[model samples]
Target chain A: MTIEQIRKTFDSFLEEHLAFGQPEGLYEPLHYLMKQGGKRLRPLLLLLATGLYDDRFERGLHAALAVELFHNFTLAHDDIMDEAATRRGKPTIYKKYGLPSGILTGDLALIYAYEQLVMGLPASLAIRLMAIFNGFAVDVCRGQQLDMEFEMREHIRMEEYLQMIAWKTAVLPAGALQIGALIGGASEEEAAILHRFGLQLGLAFQLQDDWLDTFGDEQKTGKRKGGDILQQKKTALVVYVLEHGSPEQARHLLEALKSDELQDAEKIAAVQGFLEVSGAKAAIDELQRKYTREALAQLASLNLPEARLQPLKMLAEELMGRKG
Target chain B: MTIEQIRKTFDSFLEEHLAFGQPEGLYEPLHYLMKQGGKRLRPLLLLLATGLYDDRFERGLHAALAVELFHNFTLAHDDIMDEAATRRGKPTIYKKYGLPSGILTGDLALIYAYEQLVMGLPASLAIRLMAIFNGFAVDVCRGQQLDMEFEMREHIRMEEYLQMIAWKTAVLPAGALQIGALIGGASEEEAAILHRFGLQLGLAFQLQDDWLDTFGDEQKTGKRKGGDILQQKKTALVVYVLEHGSPEQARHLLEALKSDELQDAEKIAAVQGFLEVSGAKAAIDELQRKYTREALAQLASLNLPEARLQPLKMLAEELMGRKG
Candidate 1:
């Protein structure tokens, strides 16, 4: 089935299952965020992976919802930690409700995610899924912690930054697809291969995100260009500039990034110019392509029929090609 | 085994199993809270319930730790929500570490709790335990939401108050015991009975806490007398006064409670005097006795061997007689 059909199936499942219309403060934010949908990439990937081994999409629906819910839970809490005012073009949960409500609702979302994870699967499969789900959950939290810590630290190596993003952004998709593979009757070896595939895919995905934030058109990305630059986020581009640039260049770049004297637009333009001069933008793109190639290679090693693998290949390509 | 022995075993298990010494900021708060070590009541109840059916205490150790970890996770997050500065006579996680760290550490604790819950258990039992654990986890969050909501409202009915505390405080104990029973190989019927028993015990436990906060000697309770009253918390004593007193008396009590004009000492004395005059103190004590009796009766009805039931009865009695 098409990704759209898979997303529709997952969407209806969430609407039917997620608790609603009670305890307005707690459930309202939940409904608000869940309804304001995004790419639905994780769930769609999960379903497609599951489809490769099993035709019974219904079997993977709850697990798919579980991934989606867990992803949103992290987003809600991360918005609070980042002090982000908006998400997906709307007020964040912290802004829409309040801090305490945001925390509680994020917590509720996580608990419900676990509930969905174990809903109707056989005991053996449910236990396995939970183990994978929980391992990634902890990794995601740790990743967020490291990201927060990075903001306060003075220096971060390229290796450290990659590890951070791998934990923060990559593992969820990796776990989702691997979980899908397992639930779809893949062997342990097969699941491990898909997990590797997802890890590379996730790396490429995040790099593309970093690329889009600075270079993509606002109309297509649905976000202002260079928002990350303005926020002084330590994206791959920044890391690249820090690593390869001379001491003077690095010092100047840091000054330009941190100077409150500069207007938002000025800071972004200055940082972008520095990145261009240092060839950091091209470096980041090259790294993204390398990971995307590695991900496709992992897919090739799986020995699945080419037709069955088309959807995943298309997803990886679309992620690479996305303006957003 | 005695509760002390069981606690010692659980502590050792935690030491061997819990991740430590890495990501100091995230792990430290978790260690701090877990090490501070309150009553450890939930895990003890779980062990005792498990003991009723089997002496394989080692089998339930991980699950017992899961309960303790989960309890601490709630305390850490709840401290942030209440903006509390201290817990168990030391600085809270939020006070010592900061808000974001506290939130992240609590999240890690919760994730690790799930890990502990599923460790070493067979697939079938793990799934059953997880279902029970997750259900109460959601209920506890709902209960907290209601409790927070209560602070903003003018009036809360007696029934609503009971339900709130039951969800907020009682269900965890109820679930812990039921889970222990299941792990100990109890039939569904037996687990249900223990659950009912635990519900009554939890209700009595919370009411006793309400009584102790207002009336018990501060020296013995390790807290100032009337701390709850000072915070204007709507406890059973206040609920009783509202239900039993005349409208004029109730109005006077509410005024005295709400008035920032009164000194803390004067406010406590006024509310205490009102409770005494309205016989609300006696009424609360009576309710506590009723629940305790019902709890003990449920235990009796379990019809276990006399020796097997003694520990639970002693626990109930110890809880009732505790000065703190």
Candidate 2:
């Protein structure tokens, strides 16, 4: 099936799976947030990875849903941790429901996600999947803790930022791909390679997202222009400018970051100007492109049939180039 | 193993397991709370359940560890949700390490707990344990949410209060017993019966705990005298009194609950007086005794040899009568 057909089917399963819980007051915030919906990327990756190995990818649907549900669980809780006001162009779960309800709901979603996985697979596969999922869950939490720590530090290196994104956003998808491949009867080494490919691609995807938040069109990105600048996020572009820019440019950028009273327009102009003049945006683009190349290289090393690999390569390009 | 021996083993495991991650800023709070120590009641239940079938309970130490880690995970997150100042005579994780760190660290502990469980059991047992653990996890969250809900409502029935405690504090032990039984090769029916026994006993345990919270010596409980009264908790005793008290007593109780000037001493006295005049304390004791008797009946029905059951029975009585 095509990516659209796969996405539609996966989205249907996610909705069906998420709706199976009892809707007491405790679950209100969780249900609200899980239904708010994001890109459904991890589930799609699982589905696609399995399909790449076998035409009968439907056999892996339960695994796909498990990854998706787990991903949403992390998002729900992460929103609480980040004190995020919005997600997916909507008010966040914590914003809509109080912190306590949001936390409990996130927890329920996580437990149920494991239930979904174990319900379908053999005990052996289910156990392995759970172990892998558990590892990913810990990595996500660690990445988040580091992200919180980064907030307290004065300067965050680009490498540190990359490592954090790799942990936070990349590993879950990487795990999903590897597990899906394993379920589809891929060799262990091949699965490991695919996991690396997915991790690199996921990291590149986040870097592109950071770049788009600063440089892409407001209408396309679906938020205010320069929103990240206004928030003074230490994205790759910001780190590049901080380290590489002229003294005056650094002063201007730091002034924007330091000043609580800086107008949104001024902060945006200062950071954006520094990024453009310092070639940070170009460097970011190059970094993203490099990872995309690495991801494709890793995928090619899997030595799968061309038809099976084509869809994934296309997905990588789509993810890297997309506005949102 | 004896309780002291089990405690020593668990203490060593806690140290080794918690030391796996970086023990810096974000992780320090989690380590502090987890290592602060409790009675290790849940793990003990797991081990005891296993011992009912075989002395090979040593093989299930990781599974038992899963119980304690999950318990600690709940406490860490719950401390944040309750905005609690202290736990176990020490400052709470959130209070010590800020809310975000506490949330992430607690999350990691939970993931690691499941990881440990899967490591100990085969896939089938692991999956079943996960499903049971997840179910217990949901009930725990639901109970907490209901509890938060209870704080706002003035009149909660004793029956509802009983159900809430069963969900909140009791299910984990029930699950621990059931999981242990299953791992020890008990029949599903037998495991389930033991689970029910544990649940009922835990319910009785919580009610009796409320009794001790008000009446037990400060040195024994290791908390402030009448701490629950200071918070105006609607414990089983309070709910019983509030429901059955005469209009005059109810009026005085309501006045005490509403008064900002109500000192800890006054609230305790008011609660004590209401319990006495309304015969609520006796009523709660009777209810606790009835549940305890019922739980013992269930345990008897398990058909274990009296030699094997003796310790558990004695422990139950000790739990029922303990001042702390």
Candidate 3:
């Protein structure tokens, strides 16, 4: 089946699996959030990765469901922790259901996700999949902690910023790819390579997101430019300028951040100016390119039939080729 | 090994295994909660259940850690949801570190728990244990939801109250015993029987706790009497009285609860009087006795060597022998 068909089928699978549970109060919010879909990036990535080794990619549907459910569980809890108002352009679970349901929904979603990890898989594969997923799960928490810490911290190094993004945004898709590949009967070595490919791909995607949040058109990216500036989020660009820029540049950036006289647009402009002049933008641009190049190299090294690899290749270009 | 020895070793095992993780902020509160140490009853019960069929009960230590960690995970989050100030005579995680840590700690503890379930076990058993645990974890969430519902709810049926308590308090120890028995190579039937034993035992224990909170001496129970009453918690005793009492008795109970004139001690006296006269107290007592008897019968049916079963028998006697 085509990717589009698979996605439709996945929606059916997700609803059929998690839509019903007793105590409607505890479950309706979870189903509500699941229905309010994102890109379904993690599960689709897993399914695509599994297709690399096996033609019957549908067999990995359970693993795909597990990844998606687990990802959504994090989102529900993270929304609560972040006090986020909307997800997928709609009210978050915590906002709609109140705090207790918010917490309970996330908890229950996570428990259900664990069952999916080994739900129908054989014993040895289930254990290995669990080991991989557990490590990834803990790392995600560490990343989240660091991100929250960065918000409260006075200063952050570039490496620390990267670490936070790697954990928060990068490893999830990477993990999905690795688990899917493993489930598709890929060798550990092959799956490891696919994981590296996913890491580079994910890193490039996150960097592009950071770039788009700053430099891309509001009309195109669909987000107002320089939201990170307004929130004082220490994105990779912000950290690079702070950690590596000259004192004047550093002072200018901080002043742009703290000064009341400048309007939000002016403040964003000032930060953008610093990014351009300090060459952090160019460096980050080059870094994204490097990541994309590395990701492509890994995918190419797999030596799979081109017909089999075409979808992932096309995905790489589609994700990276967007203008920023 | 003696049960006491197993408990000590379990503590050491828990520390050595879970004491290490990066991002100290995320791991510290988890370590802190695990350190504060409740009775460690679940793990000990699991180890003893394992011993019922196998002498190498220590091999079940990882499963013991998993159950204990999962239990603590619940307690940490529950404290947040309950807005509890203290647990085990100390400030709770949320109380000490704040809300984010409270939620994140529970999340991390649970993820770490999934790891422990299969950390050393063979694949098939590991999968079975996970399947069992996932159900228990979800039920606990359902139970907690019901509890919150019961709080706001004006009228609760007897069956719903029993369902809430069974989910919230009873299934945890039951799941532990069943898992340990499985690891010890008990047949599904034997493990199922052990689970039933634990269910009845846990229910009886919770009922006794309710009874002790209301009727046991302050010196013996060590809690402020009528805290549940003051909070209007729907414990078995309260639910029974509401469900089975005469209309006058029910109205009198509500009046005592709502009246501003009565002092705290007077409210306690009034409720205790209602419990004594309404036959609810006697009924709950009989129910507790029946559960204990059933639990004992399940244990006796195992027909193990007396020496092997003696410790669990002693535990049953000690727990059930408490005065209220």
Candidate 4:
């Protein structure tokens, strides 16, 4: 099935399956967050990976839904941890409801995600999927923890930042693909290759997000430009500037990030200028391109027919090509 | 093995296995909360249940640890939701570490709990346990949600109160015992009986806790007298008073519970007098006894020899006898 068809199926599953229980306070926020749509990229990856190995990708529907629910669970909790007020251009659950409801709802989502996971798979396959899912779940938490820690520290290495994002952002995608491959009856070696492809693709996707947060058109991205700069987030561009820029450039960039005197617009402009002048913007672009190429290389080496892999190739292009 | 021996083994496993990973901000609260230590009742129940059917209770060590960790995870998050400053007479994780840390640590503990669960069990058994664990996990969240909802509303029915406590406080114990029985090679029917046994015992334990909260010596309980009264918690005693008291008596009790003009001691004495005069206190005591009898009846019907059931009997007595 094509990625669009898979997404349509997944959306219907979500609509039919995501019902609220009693106590509106606990379950309402969950319904609200799930309705505030995302790209559904992780579930699509799972479906595409399954389709690559087996025609009966439909058998992996629960796993696909599980991945999407788990991803949203992380997002809901991470919003609280990050003190984020908005998600997908809508009020976050934490902001819309309160902290207790936010935390409880995320928890319910996680439990429901697990429930979805073990639904239809055989016992052995369910156990394997659980092991993989739990590993990635822990990785996501660790990544989030590191991200929070990094905010309080004055210095962080580029390598450390990469590791943090890989955990925070990449592992879910990689796990989704690997789980789908397993469900599709792929050998461990083949799943490993798909995992690698997913990891690189995820990295590129995140870098693109980081880039778009500062550089893309606001209309396309559905967000204000330079949001990362305004928040003083240490994205790839910021980390590159910190590590590779001249001392004066680094000092100016740091001051721009820390200055409460500057308005949001001024801060964004200053940080953007620093990134451009210090060549960090170009460097981040290069890194994004390199990872994208690496991901495609892994896909090419899979030896699957191009026609069968067309959906995944199209997805890769769309992810990398996003102005948003 | 005896309950004491199982507890000792479990403690050693905790010391050896509960190590935290990087980013102390996220992990330190977990370490602190685990170290604060509760009765270790849930894990003990698991071990005893395992011992009931199999001598090699050691094989269930990881599951025992998983239960304890998951319990602590619930405690950490619950304390935050309750806005509770202290647990076991020590500052709560939220009070000590801050909100984000409390939430994140709880998430980490839950993830680690899953990690612990999937370790060393056969695939089939692990899958079964996962299904059970996930069911109770959702139940706990649902229970907590109902509890928070209860706090806001003035009137709560006795049946609703019973259901709330069963979800909030009883299921973990039930799940623990049931899981242990499964690990011990019990049939599904046998596990179901143990589950019912646990449910009734858990209700007795919670009612005892409510009884102790107001009436037990402060020194023994390590908390202020009339804590539930002060908080206006809808305990079994309060529920009985509301359900059975004369209209005038119920009015007085409700006013005493809500009056800000009354001193703490006065409120406690007034509410206690109402409970005594209306026979609500006696009713709650009778209910506790009835549940305890039901629990023991289930145990007796299990057909296990008296010698094999001694530990569980002792445990039930100790739980019902706790002043603290």
Runs in model 2 lying further than 4 Å from the true structure: A19-23, A242-252, A259-262, B217-223, B245-252, B261-263
User: Higher-TM-score candidate among 2 and 4?
Assistant: 4
Which lDDT tens digits does candidate 2 get at residues B48-119? Answer: 788888788776678888888889989988887888888866888878777777777777777777887777
C-alpha lDDT of residue B87 in model 3: 88
Show where candidate 4 strays beyond 4 Å: B219-222
TM-score for the B chain of model 1:
0.96
Residue pairs in collision within model 1: none
What TM-score does chain B get in every candidate?
A: 0.96, 0.94, 0.97, 0.96
Off by over 4 Å in 1: none
DockQ, all models: 0.73, 0.64, 0.86, 0.72
| Native contact fraction per model | 0.63, 0.70, 0.87, 0.70
TM-score of 4: 0.97
Model 3 spans with C-alpha error above 4 angstroms: none
RMSD to truth, every model: 1.5, 2.3, 1.4, 1.6
Q: How much lDDT does candidate 1 score? A: 0.87
Candidate with better TM-score, 2 vs 3 = 3
Q: Select the stronger candidate by lDDT from 3 and 4.
A: 4
State model 2's lDDT.
Answer: 0.80
lDDT of 1 by residue, B1-324 (tens): 777788788778877877774456677778888888787889888988888899896778889999999998899889989999998889999889888888888888888889899888899999889989998998898899999998997677788889989999999999999989888888988998999988999999899889888888877777789898989998998888777778787788889899999899999998998888889888888898899999889998896998888887888899887554
- The estimated TM-scores of all candidates read 0.98, 0.94, 0.98, 0.97
Clashing pairs in 3: none
